[model samples]
Target: MSNKKMSGFTIVELLVVLSVIALLLSIITPRYFGKIKEGQEVVLKQNLATIRHAIDQYYSDQGMYPTNLNSLKEKRYLRDIPEDPIMKNQEWQIIKAPNEVGVYDVKSRSNEISSNNNMYSEW
Candidate 1:
């Protein structure tokens, strides 16, 4: 047999490729996660708006806010309680009206600060 060496990538070549891939991932991963966070924030805002609108509509029709979020759903004012995207849970921080008899407003259960540098609950 001839003494020619086999042609293949060396260990250095493999390491270089791996490092390039890692660098790309390091550069890309944070931006991707940031975008995901932004999307979730948008969804959270929309859900909050929808729920607030439902509460207002319920108040207009019934002359008072519902006893709970589920009451809105029960009365068909809302199809269902919207999930809090930031909190990643269905739980909402229910705000009571002046009389403390029914919901006056809602907020996210998450205490995490948003990209806007405000608490998610304050949103």
Candidate 2:
């Protein structure tokens, strides 16, 4: 019989490698998701600020708030309505001015708790 050397990983070696990979994944996955959420939160904050700033500029220019986000876009106060980073949509919770008939402020539609331990809507 001719002698032939095996050129493959053994079952034990494969198991060890797989187990190590799984262990590393277990340790890393939660943190990865947390970081993703954190990134989304930062984006959410910036989007909110941008929309609010646009609303303020519109109000300042017109002496009243725009009737809706579309109005801002119509007059070029905003190029577009920003997507809510957390909700992944353009919907927002609009607050009317105390005595005015248009958007006075905007908040995230998401009620999800943020990393800072505050509701996203409250951001």
Candidate 3:
């Protein structure tokens, strides 16, 4: 048989390919993570707004904010309380005005910082 070698990537070529892939991943991972965080923030904001609206409506119907979020469920204002994605099913922060009829403050259960570097709790 004739002496010959089948064509295939050399060790150096394989190393180069791996290096390129690692570099690409290093560059892309942070951006992808940032997008995921942004998506979470958007979802959190929407959920908070929805709950706030429901609380307002509850007040309009009943003339006062429920003693607690559970009251919403008792009154069937919501099928169930929406869990905070970041907090993984923890109760959200809720603040009621001393003499007002509805919620004056609502915030995420997760304390994740936003793009502006403000904690979700302070939003």
lDDT of 1: 0.93
Candidate 3, residues 1-123, lDDT tens digits: the string is: 668968899999999999999999999999999998888888888888878887888888988888888888889988888878778774888898787754655788666678988888876
Query: Model 2 clash pairs?
Result: none
The residue ranges of model 1 lying beyond 4 angstroms of the native Cα positions read: 1-5
Ranking of all predicted structures according to lDDT, beginning with the best and ending with the worst: 1, 2, 3
Query: Each candidate: how many clashes?
Result: 0, 0, 0
Worst 10 residues of 3 by lDDT: 101-110
Candidate 3 Cα errors over 4 Å, as ranges: 100-104
TM-score-better candidate, 1 vs 3: 1
**Model 2 agreement with the true structure over 50-99: per-residue lDDT tens digits:** 99999999988899988888888899988889999888899999988888
Instruction: Report the number of the highest-TM-score candidate.
Output: 2
Best by lDDT: 1
Q: After superposition, how far is residue 106 of candidate 1 from its true place, in Å?
A: 0.3
What local lDDT score does residue 43 receive in model 3, on the 0 to 100 scale? 81
TM-score of each: 0.92, 0.92, 0.86
Show the colliding residue pairs in model 3.
none
